[model samples]
Target chain A: MYLKVELNWNVVIPAENLDIKGLMLQKAILVRLLDDFAAKKATKDLGYLVAVTTLNKIGEGKVREHSGDVLFPVSFTCLSFKVFRGEVIEGVVHKILKHGVFMRCGPIENLYLSNQKMSDYQYQFADNPCFLSLKTGSRIEKDVTVRCIVIGVKYMEAQKEFQAVVGLEGDYLGPI
Target chain B: MQNKSGHFDAILLCFRCRHFYNLTRVFFLACDAVPFVLSLCLRKIYSRLRARLKLSFNMSAAGEEEENAADLKIGDEFLKAKCLMNCEVSVILEHKYEQLQQMSEDPMNQVSQVFEKSLQYVKRFSRYKNPDAVRQVRELLSSYQLAEFELCVLGNLCPETVEEAIAMVPSIKSRGRVHDDEAIEKLLNDMSLIKKFE
Candidate 1:
């Protein structure tokens, strides 16, 4: 799901980007903010920072005594994609393994749907491998969109990424 | 001598009758005791099982083990924040990229991989393309008084029927007690109407 969250952060303007005119200073800060926003792609708290919608406030700059850099406190609202447990999300199947399949849902790339959860489907070994449903005769192969319920979510703080285990055990949760 | 022998046989028969009656009374007592003992054991086991089941039920209700749409674990900050559907996101990203291109000659370097991938994903999955249709869809779903998350899910997925919608988002049926099947059907109808017009 995509959420528009309000956040406050302090952005620093190096000596090189600093300018005398107010308009140029504002432009420099805005550019720095966007660059920083792009660099910090994802956080544990806010799944993935997609885009900055609006810049609300830029506070008075405080000069650093040692480095001659100006620190500005900024508040903005940005779009983030965070998947909660039990969220029914659709993902494209990217890789098919013997035990399970890996899918990419939004910014989350490591969504694992194990064969144990897909009781109705059997792993068929063909020229193109796929999980063939016995009841419906539908196949889940490469690039097929599958709707699954998030069973568990793990956040890697170091990597600023989320990994989830999804399941097709629920009603109407399967290949779409 | 014959009279004395007949008296002895009568005494022996009387003693044998008393012994047989005593054996039958003991057999009946054991049969009665068996069910009483079994019932006591069953009652103990049942009470223990009921307590355990109650504990598990309470845990599940508290959103420990199982998570439903109603009991989302997303932080309170996110719950209050406005949610954007896939279609809306596509519009925003496209506009941002356009703005970037207008501002600078090299727009590709300005945007990150996350931006490009997101733009692509939303473009592929976005159900509604027209901006007016997107706004109308949001307004229509909002009228139903769904949670922000639920509203976006329904918008993004665009389930054709109430049954499919309910299946995709179970909380709509279980959490929103005011919304019955007919109301949901009407909601779905309105959504489809907008899509049809779009």
Candidate 2:
């Protein structure tokens, strides 16, 4: 069983004379963790911890200040779990290029499925878009498994484009 | 005597006014001196900061260049390997005239032409002013030829071996042969010869 959790929080800043009189005062926003819903846990289970900095103030009020949605530039060590060269993992086709197609599983960016990897599909690059075949908007909600093949990884030191090979092989592909 | 006392009092008043004026001048001078001192300190700080920032920028730029050079070196190694392999394959083909006879005349001629052109280019390009660069190029050529020989043998037996051959080739450098679209296309096609792994 997998546990999905969403945490909501509101922070209050005490009003001061400087704040009331329209003098700009720096406000330090703090992120707090409420609770975790655990489906499965071992001996030692650690809860999620987050550190945040306020980018911009969206709105202010007497009782509470309404800050705009928090934006985080998240970085991950592993984009996807390592599978065998031919094994398929379910993914949503995110983008299509002349060279390849990019797919997304969860939070990972640009898992490539090259033109050569598209098997058994009559992909017309010119007229109707191949990406439209996946029906991105609707397919995103559905769980689709894709084969994660280990193609050549091009490591460009200058641009830092780390491309990995992932594809939908044969007739076992498409939206569910 | 009474007029003399009145004259002394007038002189005393004049003296006090002059002292007051001098004090005011000194106060103004001090006020002006404060900013001058502050400005000197600020200028010194700014110069130091500017120097540090410039140094950092220079270091970062140098680092980036070094990284690019390293990447280029890797690509050069791959290219040298491919060239060497192609040379060896050509030699092998020369040894197997019977098999060559079996191939179509047009393809055989085309392959021979391409092989000869590659060899000539490699030979010409290897002759650099720098002996070290020449030596490096030669070493790369030999290794590349050996890898190509291995790939040719493998490719003849199995289709998967073609990928190894393809991987040996490096990314096309846009330098030299500007306005030569044919050459660029050939280079790109060569690089793409590697099949996407399954």
lDDT of each: 0.86, 0.37
Q: What's the lDDT for residue A118 in model 1? A: 94
Per lDDT, the best of the predicted structures is 1
Q: What tens-digit string does per-residue lDDT give for candidate 1 at B91-151?
A: 8888999999999999888787777778878988898899999999998999886888888
Model 1's C-alpha root-mean-square deviation from the true structure amounts to 15.3
- Residue B96, model 2: Cα distance from true site in angstroms: 47
**What's the TM-score of each model vs. the native?**
0.81, 0.25
Give each prediction's DockQ, rounded to 2 decimals: 0.40, 0.01
Model 1 residue A120 CA deviation (Å) reads 1.1
- In model 2, the Cα lDDT at residue B86 comes to 21
